[model samples]
Target: MNAYCFTYLFTINYLVVSVIEQMTDARQSYSIAIKNICQSFKESVEKVESIKKDSDTNNNNEILYNFWHVFIEKFQNEAELHENVIQETKAKVVTPLQCIVKHRRQQISRLKAFRTSTDYTLKECAEKVNELQSNYAEMYRIHREILQTKAIKDLLNAHNSYVLQLHMTNAMKAYYHKFVLPQLMQEFEGIVRENIIGFVQIFEYFCSIHTNMFDQLICNINGVQLKVREVSPDSVVSVIVHNLNKNQNPTHWQLIEYLSPDCDCPEILCSNQIIVDNLVKVELRDKFSELKRQFAELSSFMQQNVNIVDTLKTLEKRFDFDTQTEHINLNMHDDIYRKENEIRKAKIALAGIEVQESSNRYATHQEMHSHSSR
Candidate 1:
């Protein structure tokens, strides 16, 4: 039983340490991601600043305007938005994680100390119980020998009876009170306490990870919002027009003519609409889909963590000692009940021997009286 309890404690400790390591790894990964994102942001800022400096003297202000509106500013905004969201998410997750990790490490240290103390006490109790059992065996042996020796009937005088009574009074009572009951209670309570604490720690680990994942989902949602705001129809039109102007090398009127050669062309900006449908829609749709998929995955993992927490709660309830109204009895009770029955049997046997010895003494007295009368 002691070994089993120790094994359980070790296992719980190992698992908690493993989770902490995973959290550390996750934080490292986030650090790397944030570093990369910040680097990208720095590069985009430099690129946009360089573009502004170079294009300041450009003759075609229209080209400069379109490029800045379509590409440079868009990249800047996207890079800044991503950097902000990633930093925010890290703040939410990493800060709490550090605290939790610190707290758990302290908890584990305390638990180890408690387990060591309990183990020492248990050993002492075990040694005391073993000593008591040995004493009991010796007492029973001497008792049985005294009972069987009929030749010593006269020898079993006042002093022997006093000694027998003294031994029985001291040894039997002490064995039950100091050795048996206290040991049983200690074992039961220790097991319950150890397991309950273990389960609570596990539950805490799950909650921390669950919360972190939800924070990540929030970050992704922020990304989705930024994408939506930045990837507009006007942005698409700017990109298309810039690209067309670069490729065709035509004046605005010539490009318009090329785009709308027919007299009965669609009244709307049919060319921009076509570019939006064919190019912008497909790319944005995939982006949105990817974000939604990420969100769903985080949600699912969070739910799994919730389920684990529920299971831990149930286990904790089973071991709870607050109310006897809902006690989850241990399996050791049957063994304890068996020991109680054996003790009762011993008491009955001892009583029978005492009565037989009294009867023999009375018969001997009567026989002596009869002989005197004769």
Candidate 2:
């Protein structure tokens, strides 16, 4: 009986110890799993923190780089603006001044020849006078046309410059207000106004010249009939003059004068009492008709050359302000295109960095979990 009881007690105690050992082993495994999980979580957090720090550093660096790049870009833009202004000014003022100087020199030589002639035959003297007059007329025509065209071009340039300056100044003001005025600001309105006023004065002067030239052209045409009648007879000349007045008004006659040879009729023709006046009238009328036809052909040829409806086509092919303005506008458009492209590239680079940072963060979290499990 005693043996049986001791055996049962021992068996029960052994079973209880086995169960307790199993429970302790299970608890130890659970503790180890929890410890590993906590370690993995800590490592993951450290990795995430490191990644965040790296991302922050990278973001800061990128910001600094972008800031420096923007600063450099602005500096370069400012320098380019100054360079463009100088080039534009030179093209507008210096180039035209040089052209004017060269034209004046040629005019002076022709005037000198007219002043220095000693002895000449009647024909030679007339030819020389005609040559002088033709040169003067040509110079006057060229100068007048060139000045008119230049004034228009300069006015456009001045307006464009003013607009560009206004835009640049406004951009600068905006930049200053956004980025500079919070720390350091200065007033630039006076300087900007000075430049604008100077340019306005230049524009006003060009306008004045344009107005004067317009008035001069009107005056030049006004006395054409009187001048023609002074050199030719009333009866004979009246027919040609009337025809000229009929076919082409006074304005058209001025163009005809530019094309036709200057007729130096004898002063006797002006008087009422002239021998064979009818015959002379008929002959002069015939000549005048021929002259009108020739003038029409010459005017047509000039119009073809100039791309304008006039007898002054020679000035079109010549280098002028319009050509220069066209060139500058083309350059400005190209510059704007290039700047836009650069800005696009910068935004693309920033996006790429963001994508790379996201991919790296995911990979870093996975690596941290694997290491903690080990």
Candidate 3:
């Protein structure tokens, strides 16, 4: 009914489409970020695993109850959690629903196209209207007996019916302009505002899910850490002494120190002065080199993905979907009212022409009656 409102609605719909495109891009970045984080984390964990591989071996002192094994397992679980977020579920019963988003976007485009096609008056109607007007009677005199006085009365009756239909149409126009349209716009504005609120809430909710997962993981590890702490080197030595016959008791017990993620020079952790090192360095050399390569790749991924996450965070804050849509929605009713007024005037104008045609027809009918009576 309101041209401006309809136009604005279409405009808002296009904006929504644009926003969806941007969201798709942002989601892609998020997936890549998750991928990189998981890969980097896996490499870091593997490095520690290699360093502590033989801590519990036959000839060595164990490192803090073999905690590196736990690190490997935990790292796998942590990576799996993030990987699940980006990847489709492996279950056969639940298929991916990504197609639904695409279909909905297509439907919006279809709606826009359909509305654009049907909402306006056709050129053909105007062209045919220009060819012949209803008010101008044919000059052929096919009904020559028409009388002027009888025709006036008939026209008055027709005029009343036309006025009644026009009255109804105008009443609806008034109701829509004053109440229905404005209220509909207000509700729409609220919807847009709520979407913005939800957008921010989604950010907070996702962050909390990851943060809580990591926190709970740490808590569980802390709960189990006391077991490792309680394991004394003397108890370990006593177990070893009994396992092997007490035939050969080594006087020198090499105490194992942790090779952490921060350690750059892993050679220092190896028990060797110059003579043992000269023998051969072969135990974890391959693992160290492999981890080094993986870490390099992980570092590259981390930089790109972390920057993506940061950009998206700023984008969410900077974007104002509500403000963008509110201006159009709030002004729509006023525009509609003006357009409805135009429609009312056009209806009245056409009605005047049709009423004049009724008078022309009535005169012809009455003249025939007058001639028959005479």
Q: In candidate 1, residue 239 scores what lDDT?
A: 40
Order of models, best lDDT first = 1, 3, 2
Better of 1 and 3 by TM-score: 3
| Count of residue pairs whose backbone atoms collide, per candidate | 0, 0, 5
The TM-score values for the models, in the order shown, are: 0.24, 0.16, 0.27
Worst 10 residues of 2 by lDDT: 252-261
What is candidate 2's TM-score against the reference?
0.16
Question: Could you give candidate 1's per-residue lDDT for residues 1-374 as a string of tens digits?
Answer: 22222333333334333333333343445545434444444454455446446642222223222322332232222212222334443444334434333433443443444434434543444445445444533444455445444322322232233222333333333444444435444543443344334433433443344345555434433433343233333333344334423543211111111122123433432221111122233443453455356545545554554565555455545563322322232222223333333443243223323433343344346556767999
- What pairs collide in candidate 2? none
> Which candidate leads in TM-score?
3
Top model by lDDT, which number? 1
RMSD, one per candidate, in order: 39.9, 47.5, 41.1
